[model samples]
Target chain A: MELWYTEKQTEYFGITAKIKETLVAEKTEFQDLAIIDTVEFGRMLVLDGMVMTTVKDEFVYHEMVAHPALYTHPNPKKVLVVGGGDGGVIREIMKHPEVEKAVLVDIDGKVIEYSKKFLPEIACELDNPRVEVIVNDGYMHIHDHKNEYDVIMVDSTEPVGPAVELFTKGFYQGIYDALKDDGIFVAQTDNPWFKADLIRNVNRDVREIFPVVRVYWANIPTYPSGLWTFTIGSKKYDPLAVDESTIPEINTKYYSPRIHKAAFALPKFVEELCK
Target chain B: MELWYTEKQTEYFGITAKIKETLVAEKTEFQDLAIIDTVEFGRMLVLDGMVMTTVKDEFVYHEMVAHPALYTHPNPKKVLVVGGGDGGVIREIMKHPEVEKAVLVDIDGKVIEYSKKFLPEIACELDNPRVEVIVNDGYMHIHDHKNEYDVIMVDSTEPVGPAVELFTKGFYQGIYDALKDDGIFVAQTDNPWFKADLIRNVNRDVREIFPVVRVYWANIPTYPSGLWTFTIGSKKYDPLAVDESTIPEINTKYYSPRIHKAAFALPKFVEELCK
Candidate 1:
């Protein structure tokens, strides 16, 4: 028998991967989580029938989510990540030497548990001394913490179920409140092809709350459209204004000094959507 | 009954689209051709079980192929398109007022016929007075015509069946012989995630024949990985040095003066592949 994993990105379109074996499939407290070994992408983490991360392509998402914000801020010490249970974002956050403490708030602890067992490389940083893993509602966590973090990243799944509130204007307001005076925050907006309105709305909402709001793009094959977008909201610094020559070389697969600015150069339609 | 069309991009992964109806499914003399009306992507042209173009996202691929090389050349008068039977590239080529004539050679006549019937917008320019449509082998056409075109665009499917010869090192040499001394050419190289070797090999092979070779990228959701790459080879002009201010704003959805330069800013891994 052949086992295949399919993500129904939309009603009309989907992507499928051939699975070598199913390691774990269970109903977590928040959503259905699974760890599957695949033929092409190695181990893959699936949440609520959506691909969260895969061993082969996790570097792109992890590097892109953490580095842009960390690099743009002059001195980032306290960082926060919301809804990133797989610990990929946390792994990336540790790459910044200036970071003193990083707090992660994820509603689903099962995701973290399974990731540490299956995706060992991504979850490796979660157990470090400088990291705090909190299993709680990320929405309420942002509501409670005020002016504490220097940088915040929303490494979330699609805006569905528990993540629905994460896409609202109130959430943007909460994230703004949770950051310091010159704080920067980035969120993974959906693809422009099927979720143009979502990207437009997120950009508009983030723009209303932050002085500098920009949308950047990266290609992640396991994602919905493979063209994933990130919306960065900054209080003071501009990402494009950063000097590429000043950036130090780090171990990364996707995000580089050149890509930092190049990612901001959106296609005409995507630029129109952001506007 | 529920119907779905899946393009097995590789042995381990594929993308599936919900089909509204099958407009046409038959074997042309060259290959098996199908025109599928997809619920998500509108009308799609598929040859040899691979997607060539879709009405919804055709502009991204077509615009990226024609505009970059045309704008790089100061005043392109004669342009040649190989294997773009849907006429989408020709339609974009006509947008440049400097172009006096454009010739398109395709091996499969059924693609042109059915695209005219179903994808009328894409096939609109095939009948233009300045355009010549020939149903013949594109490889042989390039071999016969030496130093004839100011710019040549290879608008082809995946390197399979008739397109097999299009990706060879010999074909690059033939394309070099077919272009003027100051000519520029661009071809749709496959994605980096699944076909990195192909991009590397094409870049290496093209660099041997041309003075300057560059690899650029675009987001095309209906394609295999949603990330598509284009390889540009030039004899004299460098695409990177083209003054962005001089490139007039033609009507385009994806390509722009900003994108022309940004597209060449490849990701670190992709840049390494080119090197």
Candidate 2:
């Protein structure tokens, strides 16, 4: 018997990858999630019929989102990652020697548990002593924690669904308050091509709270807008004004200190939105 | 009657876009091409059933290919464009006041004529008195003419089909011989994510012929790899070292002199390819 799995891009479009066998599939509160061993993208991980990551190209998204902001801050010790239930962000944050503690807050406990069980390569670092996993709404956690963290990262889903509040100005203000004065925050904005208007609106909203706000681009093949954008907000240092000579001595597959500085250089359409 | 069009992405994977009308569908000597007026991507122009460019986001590809190499040179007098049959390169080249003469060599004559008729906004400058149109193979022309042009731009297609020779070492050496001692040449390399192997191979080939070679990236929506890379070659000057104070006084949709300088800064993966 042929086992079929579907990866939905939208309500209208999806690609079905033929699975030889189902490694794991569990019905979470959110939706049907699964991990299937595949030939092309290596071990394929999916949540709510949406693709989270494939082993072949997960480094592009995970490294790009984690390394730039983490390496930019003068001293990043206590870090908070919101909604990255897959633990990819936690894996990347461990590379920084200065990070003494990392707090991960996600609304869904099942996603985290499932990822730990099936996607061991990505979730391997979650069991480290420095990581603290909290099952709660990220918005409420940020509102309650005041001036507590040196860096905050939001790795939520798309803005249209459960991730809607993450894009609001109120949530950004909460994030601003959660960080120390010199703290930096980074979040996955969206695809710039199909969702330029959405990206523009979010930039306008985030720029209102942070003194230094910039957007960067990366390529993730599974994403709807193949050209993905990430927005960075800082209270002290500008993301573009990074010191090239002082990059951290860490082994990375996708990002370096030079790229951390170059990522903020936006194209004309994106630059117009920031202005 | 409703006209229905379906594009199959993978086996048994397809999305049907509502097409109001089909504009152009013909089998050229090179490839099968079609232009369909669609809903989401505007007038979608497809080459070999693959989406090439749309009216909505063609500026990202055009402005990126033209401005970076042009603005980096202190004074570019004569320019040569290879494989930009759409005339978008010529349109951007005419913006520089120092450019006295421009030559456009495209192997396909039908694409040029069709573009002039359909894409008037982009192809308007092709009729300029300073511009010369040559409908011959670009490889032969560059071989015959050595040290005649100050700037050479290769705006060809991907490496798979008719543009296979453009990515070879011999073509790069021919391009090196065709330029003046201080001249600079730029070509669109493959995508960074899916085409890293091709990019590395081409980078190795170009490194043999040019003293200073750099790989820069841009986010183009329609390309196979949304993370697009451009390979630059120069004889005397480094592409990264630019005079930022001297901003160009030109009205552009996508590129500025400030961006021209910034495009040379590469991510770690790209920089590692150079080494």
Candidate 3:
């Protein structure tokens, strides 16, 4: 009489949630995808047995993924999101009035299709006039479109299955080539608790390619450790140098003027990992 | 066969970890106590089926609880810890050369005994000459002591079972009465994801008694949510006003000179709750 969904985050650790009903469960070209209604998190999206996003806490991930890069750029007109089939990142990217064009490249169309039906609020801006949705491999897209995007956001899942390539050094090199001269990019680098090595490697890899690299944090409860980290690689601008007073007010629940810089102040242990 | 321990954080959510062995499981006078050796988190102390601390991540929680208050005060010679039976806070407090004496009051003596046996690294300072361990009700201890301590820390578990009174307004008033005129105190205020009301209520209650009150955060993975909060109430000093250059260097893994000020910069949603 009871159904629960659990994501085995590691070999010995996992998180579980009581489910109300399973709306959809299928195998996409890239991975297994499912949409379920849960008691604590509302509608939940799971891919390859990992909780991707929940209605209650998706704002924290989407807002943090988009706002920091968008606000750091002086005039971000073109934005690109890689592997964000849920369209949550695109929705946040489209918030800036200066964004004349926003492109989202996701290999699996089923994730986009199911999200539109189940998570409309997060995928609302995917159909906007200024947005373009492309069903293609994000890795290849970055290689093909060289120096095209002003702000690039990698909204991929953990480094497993199709996402493995997304965490390599070559992918970061491709991201550097995919951005304009003054471009900035950020990638969700997982949590520091269990993924300390992944974050350290990503920080080192990005540091070699970008002049300014910063690691920031946010509290996303549905994630592996709840303390989620993001790595930003910029060509010229330092996210910390941006005068917060000049940043325009945007509708956000988690990201704010004070939080913009605060996020960059990494904890001592986390800062050591960045080194 | 596999053995796992799950802490049901809420009606719909929980976190599970594989257990290599159960070091101790006993029914104390107050609650159920267990020392589980986990595959991922090393030895973990569980009280009433909730994780109290783990060997791997205990540094983050203990450092944040003690360092901020100790460094903020001009010269804290006398300190008091309430309900910290594990003695992790006392270990961190003893690091301060200025502290001449540290008093620990807990409702249960079994926690202190087991911690001394199992989590020796965390409870190492429990037998220090300066630390006086007393198995007594923390609530009554605060009501008895008046203007006796320079810094007081309430290291109780979530406001449940025996700790329910520790979160009430009268307890905050008692803590205010138990501290010197220029004293400062802090308490673990739970997380914001599930316990927003608790954080809001504690902030309001402390604000009523102290001239200055602030909320800070740290990442503690074994707890319900990795994003843990701490509420600090000061009578004559603002924690934010402390000079980082003056807070002498200490041996720590999480708290740093820069992190002292950064932890106070909360996320937008969390700040909104404190308001």
Candidate 4:
């Protein structure tokens, strides 16, 4: 019997990948997740039946979602990462020398545990002293903490299920409340190609609270919409006005100081959202 | 009847798009190309059964390929575009105020004529007096010319078929010879995720001839690999050391002085190629 896996890009298109067997399958309290070894796309990671990351091209999503905000801030001291239970964001954030403390908040604990066990390189820094792993609702955490974090990076799955509320204006305002005046907020918005309306809506929502809001593009191969968008919201500095001279001297697989600034350069349609 | 359109990603994985009917189908001398209204990706341009650009998201590829090199040079007096028959590069190059002359060299004149007739908005600026249209081989043009251009942009098709030579060391050396001492050379390299080997090869080849070589990424939806890379080669100045104060004053859709400097930043995988 062939194991069937469906990849829903949006409502319009879906690719069904037939797998040999379920290498790892679990029904976590939050969602159904699995990591399957396949002939195509190499090793695949799916959460709640939604494709999250694949070994073939996980670098694009992982690097883009983590690097831009981490490298953009002047001095990222205390950082907060919400919904990235996979620990990829934590790995990238740890590359910065100034990041004294990092808090990983996700409603689902199983995702972190599974990722830590399987994807060792991505979750290498999870055991580091600087990290404080918290298994709880990220929304509540944001509301509870005020003016505490220098940077808030949201590495969500998608705008569906438990992650839907993260895209709302209320959650964005809560994020604004959680960050210091000079702090920066970066969230993985959906793909503009498949979800233009969502990208536009999220940009508008983020712009309402933050003085500087910009949408950047990253190409994640495993995603339904190949072209993905990340929206940056900041209170102090523009996302485009980053200092190139002060890049962190760390060995990173992705996320260089040069890329930090380039990531904010929007395409024509994405740039139109700012207008 | 279901009209089947297979977008050949590689020899292995080809995405089959179920279409209703052909909106516009024409066979040029080089390849069979068509513009079809599809159920999933909207109005899609299919060249040799591969999706080149779609109406939903062509800006990512067009803007990224055009903006970085155009904006980086302090003063772009003369610009030469290689293989951009679609006229998208011309549209972006015209945004620079200092660009007194813009030359386009495309082997397929039919592609230029068809794009001008079909996609007028993208090909609108082709008739500008400063824009010189040349129907010849881009490689030959570069080999013959020397120290004439401030910026040389290669917006070729994939590194296969007619474009295979464009990825060679000889071609890059020709581009280097064509550029002025302080001139910049930017070309669309392969996607980092799907075409890592190809990108590395191109990086290696370009680095041999040019003093400075760097690879930058862009999110293009229609391409085979969603994670696209652009390699830049310069003779004198590093792209990262661009002067922000000297940025050109132009109403651009994407490229800015801020982004010009940022495009030089590389991910670890790409930066490894430079070493």
What is candidate 4's lDDT per residue for B126-203, written digit by digit as tens? 999989999999999998899999999998888765677898999998998899988999998877656778887887
Candidate 3 lDDT tens digits, A1-275: 99988888889999989999999999988899999999999999999999899999999999999999999999999999998889999988888989999999998999999999999998998899999999999999999999999999999988987899999999999999999999999999999889999999999999999999999998888998788999999999889999999887678888988888988877788988999
By DockQ, the better pick of 1 and 3 is: 1
**TM-score per model over all chains:** 0.99, 0.91, 0.98, 0.79
Native-to-model Cα distance after best TM-score fit, residue B230 in candidate 3, in Å: 0.8
The DockQ values of the predictions, listed in order, are 0.83, 0.39, 0.77, 0.34
The TM-score obtained for chain B of candidate 4 when compared with the true chain B: 0.89
lDDT against the true structure, each candidate: 0.92, 0.79, 0.93, 0.77
Candidate 1 residues lying further than 4 Å off, grouped into runs, are none
The TM-score measured for candidate 3 stands at 0.98
lDDT of 3: 0.93
Better of 1 and 4 by DockQ: 1
Compared with the true structure, what per-residue lDDT tens digits does model 1 show for residues A1-275? 99888888999999999999999999987888889999989999988899989999999888999999999999999999998988999999999989999999999999999999989988999998999999999989999999999999999989987899999999999999999999999999989999999999999999999999999999888888788999999999999999999998898888888898989999999999999
| Candidate 3 C-alpha lDDT tens digits along B1-275 | 89999989988999999999999999999999999999999999999989999998999999999999999999999999999899999999999989999999999999999999999999999999999999999999999999999999999988898999999999999999999999999999999988999999999989888989999998887777678999999999999999899987688888988789889988888999999
Model 2: CA > 4 A from native: A1-27, A32-40, B1-20
Residues B98-188, candidate 1, lDDT per residue (tens digit)?
Answer: 8999999999898899999999999999999999999999999999999999999999889988899999999989999999989889999
Q: Could you tell me which residue pairs clash in candidate 4?
A: A258-B265, A259-B265
Candidate 2 structure quality by residue, lDDT tens digits, B81-180 = 9988888889888988889999999988887888888877778899999999999899999999999888999988877577889988999999999999
What value does the interface RMSD of model 3 take?
A: 1.1
Sorted on TM-score, best first, the list reads: 1, 3, 2, 4
